[model samples]
Target chain A: MILTVTPNPALDLTWHVEALSPGATHRVPTAAARAGGKGLNVARVLHGAGHEVLALATTGGATGAEFTAELAASGVPHRLLAVRAPTRRSAAIVDDRRGETVVLNELGGPLAAEESTALHDSAVQLARDAGVVAICGSLPPGFGAEHLGELVAAIAASGVPVVADTSGPALLAAARAGAHVVKPNREELEQATGRAEPLAGARALLDLGAHLIVVSLGTEGLLVVGRSGAPVHARLPEPLHGNATGAGDAAVAAIAAALATGVDLAADTDAAARARLDLARRATAWSASAVLMPLAGELSPRHAELEAAVVATPIHEESR
Target chain B: MILTVTPNPALDLTWHVEALSPGATHRVPTAAARAGGKGLNVARVLHGAGHEVLALATTGGATGAEFTAELAASGVPHRLLAVRAPTRRSAAIVDDRRGETVVLNELGGPLAAEESTALHDSAVQLARDAGVVAICGSLPPGFGAEHLGELVAAIAASGVPVVADTSGPALLAAARAGAHVVKPNREELEQATGRAEPLAGARALLDLGAHLIVVSLGTEGLLVVGRSGAPVHARLPEPLHGNATGAGDAAVAAIAAALATGVDLAADTDAAARARLDLARRATAWSASAVLMPLAGELSPRHAELEAAVVATPIHEESR
Candidate 1:
């Protein structure tokens, strides 16, 4: 089983309108609301793929109740911790005429000290029997990067591999805490390491004690790097276009699914190298498949065909 | 006591941002949520002025919980009927850089047949002891204009005068049901009566069995017509420029407040004419004062000064 922790979750609302006009009143013809956050998306992808996964997050207030009810309706296995502050909401307005989407995200309120401590303790305990743990999303107010570092260290100490999917200072903290794998998209990697080159950014995470660094390059595909051996790259023959909001989360789900088999990449053997290549191919295909779906936390049924079309290669020489 | 009924109440959320760029994601720095609807705003204005008032509306689902909690915190006396459908929400994005506001309103879900019947029965019973009753706002899905007409007729049957502030066909429905006073903005009046002139529109409403017709003309002040006597016109010495969203509701509040004194305009006596002039002056002043307020359900403290600046006159000749 895999355990997923979402520090900040949202009741995501989407409104469909004819078109968007700034400073004008719009009557939405259709609207939908669901439970959303990076970790929850990851858990949903895994669960849909017939994997056993448990989603953990903190919920409170009226919006929190709505979020919990939505998650339950989705039939996703989950446990929620109660807090005092109301959950934040994110709204997206999809304009059909112009084919544009405008989003508004609320900054979540501060978490109590005890609530943060309780979340950390709960996550560590839940990871005891899991083969791998995935910690995803932004750090909420009052939750410093150091808290994420401590949680990552504690979960890794329990002999379960931890995958950190975050950005900025939190990404560095997770790497320094000895997380087994860290995934950062191209823009996030640049923001965290201040390095325009993806390889240089991946090397920065490796130097911080991370066993593997996977960088998502959008249409360019996936790049995997480690302390030893040449970095691997994977991509499909053509680019797919649809909704790209959940592509990264689906990629992270593929990585977690691969690691749940108790495969140890630190062994540096032929089997480890082959497993790394498989992870890259699967991640690229899953991400592309997600782009074909209209909403997040869903994948196209042609994932196997997409994986078969992927071409993964090892970079023995430096390349841009 | 005055009773206000809002058939389609909303939990209004406001988000403040520096600027708005279509198709871009905005991180709202500040946000606020409160219970809002036309009738509720009227009740709030009356309550703020030390008048005994009760607000009645329907609430359900998560958004309803938040609305109920906020109404409780506001200290406004209210009784809400629960339904299966979630309450609707309206969001406004205030862009400081552009000095503009963008609004998105959700059409409330359908009310169950039993729920609608229950609300009508409850309102009629509650209005039994009220000096005047005010019905405001749009009809929710599954609720037709005939329902509003019936509700108004039922409340008025209990000997409580009904002041209706609504739009479209609902405005005509209320007038046809013998509403004591019906207030509609110039645009709404034109839409409901299919008349280009405000006086003609007011006459149309009066022909439908309404006792009084008050048409708000934005910066042009108000045009009031009734079953007897010449039409009255009221305006401030100078037009005040500010938020005008709640100005009409404030006008309705003033009318309800004046009627709560048990003054009978149907008597057609000299004292009754004097009371109509007073009502016109107060309504114009209160409506202008509301323009200075940033949010609905609030009146400026300078209402007395504004009232002193109003000039009201009776029109004996036909005018546009």
Candidate 2:
């Protein structure tokens, strides 16, 4: 089973309005709420594709209860550690008239030291039994980069490959902790490494000890790079136009699913290179397929056709 | 004792951000949630003033639990009847940079038939013990104007004065059911009676059997009209510039508090006229004082000073 950990999960609330005016009052007839976080989204995508997956997160208060209840109702297997502070909420106001969404995310409240330690211990224990583990999303307040580094190191030491999808110092922490793979979108890569070019940013992570780096380039698809191999750039012929909120999580799910299938990436051989290329192609296709779906946790059923349409080409190291 | 009924109560959530831009993601460091509704605000105002008050409303689901928990934490005496659907939420996004707030209100989900009957029965029974009963805010989905009318009629028949603060057809229904007083803001009055002028709109409610029509005119203060004699206009010498969100509810609280003290308005005598004027002056002052406060359900401590500054003048019927 694939294990996913979201340090700061949220109860996502979405409201659709005809138009969004800066200072006007709006009446929303109905609203939708569900459990959300990058790691949870990764688990959902894998589960929807008939893969065995388990989502782990910290929750508290009434909002946390609602979040856990929604996950149970959705039938996604999950184990949540109780914390002291209430789970934060991320409200997305979708403007029907403007065809765009504005999101207001609450930075989660501080987690107690004991709560953080409990989560770290739980993630390590769960990772031992899982085929692959993915640590995702932003860390909650008081959950420092050192904590993320220690958790990733413990999970990686458990003999299971750990993948991390986070931003800022946490991204570097996961990489330095020897995560097998790390995924960060274009903007996040820049924010973490201060590198405008994806290749340079991927190199920075590789220099920190990450085995492989997968960068999601939005409509441009995925870029896969390693410490010493020809980087692969995978993209579909035409960009798909739809919601892109869950694309990176879908990419992470694809990478985790591929790694769980016993692909040996430690050896320097032609077979290993081909396996890495195949992984890159699958991730790009899955990420693109996610754009066609409306909600974050959902994936389009046309993933096979999308996989076939992806073009993976090796790029010269000196290009950037 | 005063009873305040909020048919469609909300868990009010407020978030502050630097600025609101369409299609942009914002990070809210913290957020605040509390029990809110027109009637609940009225009850809060009364309770804050050291008056005996009970707030009543229907609640369901986890959000409802949070609402009740917050009220309990605040030490507000309340009774919440359980319903099937979750209580609605009103989110206010305060733009710190722009110095404005945008509100997104969710109209509550449909209430079960049995739940509606239970609320109706409970409100009427509670009204019997209350010195003054105030029915406030909008009715939930499936709880029609007819339900409001029936509830008001039953409460009025119990010999307790009923004050209603609602808009649209519900206001007319409350008036026709012999509500002792009705408070509607300027825009609500125009929408209900299709009269741009408050005098004409107040006259329409009077013709429908309402004993008093109190129109909240925002910065301009209040216009109080009865079925006979001269209408009274009351205003503070200077407008208090602050949040006016809970101003109308504070006015209703003042009117209810005044009536609870055994001010008889049944006779068209000189004493009754003076009592009506006093009620108008108090309502105006209390409302202005509420504007000076930051949050809803809060009143400024300068209410007494505001009351002394209020000017109540008899308006000639021929002037309309």
Candidate 3:
């Protein structure tokens, strides 16, 4: 079983607008709400891929209750550590005409010290029971990188492989605490490595005691670096376009699933990379299908066809 | 006492971002959540002016509860009709660099028949006890213009003057029901009267059985029409830069306050118009002041200054 921990979760509200004119009023044609958090999205994608996954997160107030209800409705198993303040909401305004998307995120309120302890306790318990644990997303206010780093250390102490997916200081702290895998996108990788090249960034993270490093390159594909072996590259054939809101989470989900199922580390990295590419393609198709249907549960056959085309390729040193 | 009714109020969430590039992720620097709805805004402005005001609106679900809590925190006197379904939320992403405000509003779910009846019953009770009642804002989903029209008629039947502020079919329906006053902006006026001229539009509503008509001309001023008078034009000095969101509501609030204080109809129109401009100016000042001091009380001084500048001017002839 794969366990995912989201420190700060949100109810993502998306509004579809024709064209966005600044300072001008535009009526929204459609709106949708989904339970969102990096870890929650990872768990959702894992579950969608027929994996056993449990989502653990800290939630509070009315929005928290709504988030829990939405997760239940989506059939995603989750345990919420209730706090005093409300969980923040994130907004995504999709301007279809210009193909632009603007995201507005709230800096969630601080959590109590007791709540932080409770979250750590929950993560420990879940990590002990699961084969792989992924801690993802931004830490809420009042939770410093050191605090999150401690949680990552505690999970690693349980002998479960830990995947830490986050950015900024938290990512730095988690790497110092020795996470098994750290997934950072290209920009984040640059910040982590202080280098523009993917190889240099991946090497920097691995040097920080991360056993493996996966750097997401958006449309460019994924870069993998390991301690014992030379770096491997997994390339996708097509560039996928869509919201890309949950694409990183999908990639983490694939990695967690592959690791738990005993796929070889290099093979798993390749598989995870391809899975992300495929998911991106599928996501784009699903989004297009939604334009025509505007409702869930009505994906076009093209979505499945795109998913089928994703092939995991392992690049060994000899091949390189 | 002046009463304001908002059948479907919302928690207006505004996210201020540097620049919004749609389809790209952005981190918001500032976020604010306030109780919103046309009637609620009117009530807030009235309360700010030290008027005896009671805000009545529906509250339901978690968001509604939060909305009510926020109102309480802000010291706004309100009576919310609790409903089963959650109240809706609207997100506005303001890009200060581009001066664009993109709004995504939820299609607020409809109230049940019983809920609708309860709202009407509450409005009737409030109207019976109040000197003036204003029914404002767009009707929530599942409610037709006729429902609002009937509600206005019910309030008017209580012998208290009823002011209906709305647009589109709802305005026509309310006017046909013989509302004491109808306020429509230029666009709404054009839609209602099929004329671009404010005078023509105000006169059309008067012919449709409205006893008094207030046509808001945004920056120019207001055009007031009554049975005994030809038309009254009230002008306002151009306000400094500010968000004009609640300006119209502030105008309604001022009108109700002036009318309750026994001001003549023409005088009331001019007072309201000037008050609106003042409100716009102060609201802008407050927004800027809020950046330095995040205290709600800090806005009081500006509010008072704006109130002092509110001058009512009567117009004997309409400006071409």
* Candidate 1 residue lDDT tens string, A1-320: 99999998877777777877876677764357788888999999999999999999999888899999999999999989999988888777767677556777787877899999999999999999789999998878877789999999999987899999999999999999999999999999999999999999999998997899999988888998877777899999898765567789999999999899889865588888888889899999999998777667888999999999999999897554
lDDT string, candidate 3, B1-320, tens digits: 89898877877777777777756677764457777787887787677767888999887776787788788987878889888777887666666676445665666778898888888888888787799898888788656688888888887776777788898999998898888778888899999789887877888887887877877666555666676534555543444344446656655665676567654453346555454343333433332322222222123345445434534355566453
Candidate 2 per-residue lDDT, tens place, B1-320, comes to: 99999999999888888888877778887578889988889999999999999999988888899998999998889999989899899888877777567888898988889988989989988887899999999889778899999999999998899999999999999999999999999899999999999999998998897888999998899998887668899998888776566889999999899889978664488988988899889999899888777678889999999999999999985565
> Per-residue lDDT for B75-119 in model 1, tens only?
999999998888898777777677566777788889989998988
Q: What C-alpha lDDT does candidate 1 achieve relative to the native structure? A: 0.87
Worst 10 residues of 3 chain A by lDDT: A289-298
Model 1: residue B204 alpha-carbon error in angstroms: 3.0
Worst 10 residues of 2 chain A by lDDT: A263-272
Best by TM-score: 2
Which candidate ranks first by DockQ, i.e. highest?
2
Q: Which stretches of candidate 2 lie over 4 Å from their true place?
A: A219-222, A230-244, A264-281, A305-314, A317-320, B229-244, B264-285, B288-294, B302-319
Global lDDT of each candidate: 0.87, 0.88, 0.70
lDDT (10s digit) by residue, model 3, range A1-320: 89999898887777777787767666664357777878887887677667898999877776777787788899988888888878888777766777556666777878888888888888898787899999998888767798888988888877788888999888888888888788898998788668898877777777777877777666665666666544555544675544556656666775686568654453345565454444334433333332233222233345455445543344455432
lDDT of 2 at B288: 88
Angstrom error at residue A224, model 3: 2.6
- For every model in order, the fraction of real contacts preserved is 0.73, 0.90, 0.65
Model 3 chain B weakest lDDT span, ten residues long: B289-298
Docking class of 2: medium
Give the native contact fraction of candidate 2.
0.90
